[model samples]
Every structure is written in C-alpha cells, then in structure tokens.
Target chain A: MLSENSDKIQLFKYLEGIFTELEQQKIALDKSAIVAFTDIKGNITYVNDKFCEISQYSREELLGQNHRIINSGYHEPKFFRNLWKTIARGNIWSDDIRNRAKDGSYYWVATTIVPYLDASGKPYQYVSIRFDITKQKNQELELVRRSKQLEDFCFIVSHNLRAPLSNLLLLTSMIQESDDSEEQKELIGRLVKPVHLLNETFNELVESLQIRQDTDIEKVNLSFKDCLENAMEALNVAVLYPDIEVHHDFNEVPDLKYPKKYLDSIFQNLLSNAIKYQSPKRKLQIRIKSYLREGSTWLEFADNGLGINMKVQGHKLFGLRKTFHDNPDAKGFGLFITKSQIEAVGGMIYAESTQGRGTTFFIKFNAK
Target chain B: MPNDPMKTIDTLYLIDDDDTYQFIVQRTLNSLNLVNSIKLFSNGKAAIDFLEATLHDIEQIPDVILLDLTMPIMDGWQFLEQYLRFRPRIGKKVVIFVVSSSIDPRDMQRAKSISEVTDYIIKPLTKSKLISMLHESLES
Candidate 1:
C-alpha cells in the first residue's frame, strides 16, 4: 500500500512539471508575437496584448470583431479564399498579409495560422501568429520601383533622345551644301530650332536623372488652388490664353500632403496640353475638380479641345517621345513626365478622351 | 515606258516634317534640273488626301515620292499601308524613295520588304545618289 501511494505521488509531480513548462511557453509566445484566436467562423475569440498594440485597438474592441475588421484592401478576395480553404482543411496557412490599423496606417505581417481540429477532424478554431514586416515590405517595394524607373530611363535614351539628334544631322547637312551667303544665313537662322530642341531634351533628361538618383522627396501640405495658380502664373497662360476659360472646384478636397514639385509639374503639364491642343473652331474650356471618393482623394481635369482618338492611339498616349497631334511644338514630353511624377508618389493618373470632343483625366491619390 | 531616256520625271512629292530638309531637297532638285515641279507636305495625311482625290487622273499623281519615315500625323509605314490599299484604283506606277536620317537596320529592312519602296536612302542625299535612284526607278 505504501509503494502504491509513492507511485501515485511521482505521477502527479511529473504531470505538474509538464503543465508548468507549457504555461511558461504560452506566456513567452504572447509577449513576442502579435497573436490572435478565432472561431471556425472567423470571428475573433481572443487576442494577446501584442495584437491589440500593433492594431491600435483596445482589447475590448478587438475581442468580438471579425478578423476582416483589419483588412487593408491590398489583397484580393481570391487570396483570402485560398487562405481560408487551406486552414479549414486543418492545414497550417502561411502568407504575408497587409492589414490596416485603427488609425488608418498600413502594416504588413508575416503570418502563420494553425487550425485546431475536433474529434471529427474538422477545424474548431484557428490560432494566428504574426510578425510585423512593414519596414521590410516597403524596402522591397521601393527597390522594385527603382529598377522599373531604370528600365524607363534606358528606353528614353534609345527612343526620345534620337529625334533631336536627327534634327542636328539634317541641319548639319543643310550647312554643308549651301552655296550662297544669303541661303547660308537663312540656314543658320533655322539651326537655332534644332539647338533649342536638343537643349530642351537634355534638360528633361537631367531632371529625370535627379529624380531617379535621389528618391527622397520632401512632402508638405499643398493647396490645390494655390499650386494651380502658381503654375499658370509661371507659364503666363493668363496673358497667352486670354480667350481661354478656366474653371475649378476644390471645395471637397482643398489640400493634400505631397511633394510640391510633383504637384506643380502635374498641373503644368495638363494645363499646357489643354491650351496647346485647343481647337481652332472654338474657344478653349477647361474644368478642374477635386473630391473624396471610395476612401481616396480624386482630381479631375477636363478639357474641351481637340481630344485624342483613344481607340487608335490609346496605347501610346503617355508613351515617351511620342506625338499623336500634327503640331510641330508637340514634343510628346508632357504626359510622360506627369505620369512619372504621379506614380513616384504612389498615386495614379489616367485619361478618357473622345476625338474632337473632349478629354478628362482622373488622378487618384493614396490614402495616408 | 521602262527606262525611256527621253521621258524625264516632271513632278515630285516631298512628304516630310523638317523644313530644312524640304528646303535642301527643293534647291537640290532645282539646281540639278532633275524634276520640273516639287510639292511639299508637312505630313503624310495631306499627301494621302491628294492621292485619293486624284485617283482617277494619273497625270495629277507625282512621278516619284521622297517620303520621310517619322512624320507627325501619319508615319511612313502607315502611309505605305494606306497607299497599298488604293494602289490598283490609283492606276499610277509611282516609285517611292524612303528618306530618313535614321540608320537603324530594322528600318532599312522594313523599307526593303515593301514592294512600293524603290530604295532607302540615308539623309543628305548627294547628286550622284539622286541620279542613281532616278536611274534605278527608270529601269524598274
């Protein structure tokens, strides 16, 4: 009877030691990771302090909320469908997820979700362990963007720079074959155009080079109205386009936090294009509007001018060193630079045009 | 009429955007007395319109066309496509000489494959090159 009692006591102590070790491991995991538990239906059942801290939510706010409350809209529905399917099959699902915080900041997480199964081999609950990867993800995205910029630069070198050089060659030939002094003087007068064309092209290239070399941009709060006014003043469009009608509505979104230079460039390019392509049949009419929609700020610039035939020239609208119009001054440089500036700041710009009717451009800015 | 030494080209069409090139070619043609009349168009569209309007009258069409490749409205390649469509209706055996400052091999190859294009000449055409081109056009 004494030996039997001793054996029972030894078994109890062994069980107690295992329980203590398991409890310590759970505490350590809670401290180190952003951890959460959800029922099979994806409703949040429990969350560790680290989860609440990173998500910028109180424990009470996070507990009963669905896992989708933190959805960033960065990933498509197919991604979640695949993830859920994997976890529901009692398999561990792992991926990088972009999540939105309560304060509207974006974060990335390297996540692993393990599903706990019931007796029937069905998942009863899911336990997710996530490590913050926001910094690393931004770095990787920037690197990819920079390489794409380099590829664009190489294309510009091969394509856009050649036109001016062609002009130089033609002018050189003209200078060579001229016999009379008067004809030579006239040819000399024409040489200025090709020289100016080469200078403009080089200036544009140098500007792009600066932007590419130093990716750092200083962002500040910018007023749309002020920026547009400044651009117009600099271009002297008020005097040059006395008959042009310009209208704007900036009540919905008056200001944005962006690089001042980029904003100025965007405004200048679109305005110049509107004026330069104005129809000889009528007075120019341009409308600029800004508003908030679908959690993003949008700017619409519309012009009733000689619009493009999108069906035929849509693909090359913003192509480098391309011109669809017959105007000799149309260097095909404006839209290309505008696109570069917008995309560099994580914004998007697109256009809708009907030939001989009108053109409208939509710019969607990123939500901070 | 092939290689008839007595019949000289009377009319020429210069389709190019560069004014300097237009002036140079006009003066050169006058100096050499190679052609009697020269017409200049800033782009291919105007030339195409002329050709289409004058399709029934063979005399209105130019004897030779010196076409620049990179024009603003319609490029040289596009011009060729449009021209080939109306070739049978036009009823004119016009020789086209592609003139370009670009020495790109792809451009040269592309010009060679077009049956309507008689020759591809690098820009700053010499009098000798012009004579050779005219001779080739006559022979063909």
Candidate 2:
C-alpha cells in the first residue's frame, strides 16, 4: 500500500510540471499586448502584460480594479456605453482606439474585444487584444495628402495643356482644308508637324490621366466582330501601310458581357503596336484568335515584328515611361496603360517573345 | 440678310468667341452654299441681345443656332436655360444645335434631354456634316 501511494504522488508531480509549462506558454503569448477586463463584480479576472505596462500596475493591481482606472478620457461616456451594449449582447467590437499610457502620453492601438461567459451562461469578463498601428496610420495619412497634391498637379497640367492642343487641332484642320497655293500649303504643312507632335504628347498625357481616374466596370453583351470593326475604324489612318495584314478568327468566341471601352482600348493599343513596330525584313502580320478555356475567354494577339528581348526589357516592359524599341513613335505608355486598363476591368495580360522571331500577347477575360 | 424666305429659312447663326472658328465656319458655309446668310456672334450675351431686340421686328429668325458648349462669359448650358425662357416669345421655327469639341458622353446625353436642343454635333464640323444638317432642317 505504501509503494502504491508513493507512485501516485510521482504521477501527480509529473502532471503539475506539464500544467506549469502550459501556463508559461500562455503567459508568453499574452505578453504580446492582450488584456482581460471584468466588471465591478470580479470573476476569473482580467489578464495582460500590456494592460499592466500601460497602467503602470501589475496583473495583481488590475485584477480587482474596474476598467475606469485605465480609461484615457479620450472616449466619452456614450462611447463606452455603446461598446458595452454591443459586447454584452455577445457581439465583437473591433476598432482603432487611442489610450493614455502610464507616462501621460497617448498611443494608438487596433483593438478587438471578445466576451467570456460563466457557469450560469452570464457575462463574466472580456478579453481584448491590441496591436500597435499608429505608424501605419500616419503613413497612410501622408500618402493621401501626397496623392491629393499629385492630382492637383495633373488637373493644372490637363487644363493648361488641353486648351493649346484644341487650338492647334483647329488650326491644323483650317490649314489642311484651306485652298492655298502649293508653296503656301507646303509652308503650312511644315508648321503643322510640330503642332501634331504637341497634340500627340497632350494625348499621351490625357491617356495617363484617364488611366488614373476611377474605372467603372459595366458588363453588357458585346459582339467580338463589332468590337474588332470599331477598333479598325479608329485606327484607319495609322494602319494605312499597304504591307500590313490583320487576320481575325473568332470561331470559338461568343458574345461576352464585359467592360466595352477597356476591351476596345486593349485591342486598339495592341493592333497599333503591331503596326508601329513591324520588322524591316518582313511584312507585318497580326493574327487575332479567341477561344474559351475553362469558362474564361482567352484572346491572343500574335505579331510578326521586331520582338522584345525578354532577357533585358522584361523588368520594365509593363512599367510606366519604359521604352524598349528603337521606333521613334514609341511613347512607352501604350502597353502600361493597356495592361492597367485591362486589369482594372478584371482581366489579365501576358506576353511570350523571342529576340528576333516574334511576340504574342495572351489576354484572359474573367468569365461572366 | 437675304430677302428670299426659303433661303433665309435655312441660314445659320454661329455664336463663339474664337475668330478662327468663326472665319472657317463662315467660309465653309459659303463654299457649300447651304444657307443664304451666316449670322455671327462673339458671345452668348450678344446673341441673346440680338434675339431679344429683334424678336418682333425680324421677318425670319435663323433656322439653326450653332452653339459652343464652352464660352468665355456665358456657356452653352447657361445659354440654353436662358434661351428656353425666351423661346416661347420667339418663333417656334428656330432650332438650337449644340456644337462642341468635348467627347464626354454625359454632355451629349444632357443635350439630348433638353427640349430646345435639336442636335449635338462634335467638332470640327466637316463640310458633309453641314450639308447633312441642311438636309435634315429641310426635311424637318
């Protein structure tokens, strides 16, 4: 009997050692700024090292004390009452709160509070975990301020630049259509070139602004053939080179309900790029093919052009103000804006290319 | 002004501050021979004054008013509002056409909704479009 009692004592000692190890782990986790609060009628009690640190009191000092002692007075009575009303009904309250530290300085915390119930199923205490988010909040505010400044700058640039551009367009139309002598017409044409360049620059600026503006995505049934025809119409002047050939095969594509302008611009930019960067050795051939794969519409723009060197330009290919080709007309904005416009309306763009062979752009539209 | 009632009925009244636009449009109208006479106004106020003063005296008001949506003092939208108030006073034969360079669809939709606006045309107005407008006016 004596031997059995001794064995039972040893087993109890081993269980106590395991319980203490778990308690230590729990305490270590709580040290990451978790606190528990109880009402005036004390129960299992409040817990947290952060609560002790902020209040300049240990867990022993905070256990029996009401939440009023640590209250920073930053929040009014109504704020606390509303918080209680929400939590007492077994709902969680999560928000950013400013609390006064023991040193009389204030700190911001993102807080989440959860309530605990006793044996009678009545509210006993609340466990609150808080993370320091003051630095992030400050950075966000600064970013907002800087963004507003940038938008203001863009507004000024747009107004100042567009007015002159409108006048230049009017002037060019007047000069071009005017019945002038050959000599006079040549002089006017010479003058029109710079104005055209200015107009193109302004157009690029406006395109960038439009990209920055909020994108409103609306889905409507649109025919692929109609969209292709519209793009061709818009690019009639640019695609006048007799050598270039564009072929479209839409056997698999059905009417899709997607953002129309985004798709239109995507096709326009890609087609224009194909025509703009044609290889000197070969005639430009652009083949557009569409197919449905796994409930998504996949369209490919395959071009026979001076293809991109993915080994070098891949890093900056879709980045703003990045130009890779030696083509004088390359603004480096086409693919960047095109990619953003596509993604803004919930589509993805990818490219496959070799240095001298050709390039193909694959775009996948989300299934309706 | 031309004396023939038929010719005068199809005349254009252009209101804009830009001298170049005025000159170009007048030249285009003459080349096309679409109208008898082209009345010009530098601003909305001048146009309004001309209409109000000659409301009863003039034998025929213009067939079409080519209005610029954006102007120095009074814009096309404001002109429409004020013109509508005086429209009943003027003859019902006149039609207001909003001519603007803005490609914004909202502006086009707004113009379409207005009772007084006959049509919204994007600039720079070509010779064929002007001829088409004359044809439309004759049919209407």
Using TM-score as the measure, which candidate wins? 1
- Tell me the spans in candidate 1 whose CA falls farther than 4 Å from its real position: A1-160, A173-179, A279-282, A294-296, A309-312, A323-328, B1-8, B101-110, B121-132
Could you tell me every candidate's TM-score relative to the true structure?
A: 0.64, 0.41
Per-residue lDDT over A141-177 for candidate 2, one digit per residue giving the tens place of the 0 to 100 score:
7999878756654543443344335555655665667
Each model's lDDT: 0.82, 0.71
Docking quality (DockQ) for each candidate = 0.14, 0.02
lDDT of 1 at B37: 78
Candidate 2 residue-wise lDDT, B1-140, digit = tens = 22333552455689866555576578667876767768898778888888787778545467788998766456678878888888778765777788775555667899999977889987667767776777667566
- Pairs with backbone N, CA or C atoms under 3 Å apart (clashes), candidate 1: none
Deviation in Å, model 2, residue A268 alpha carbon:
44
True contacts kept of 1: 0.07
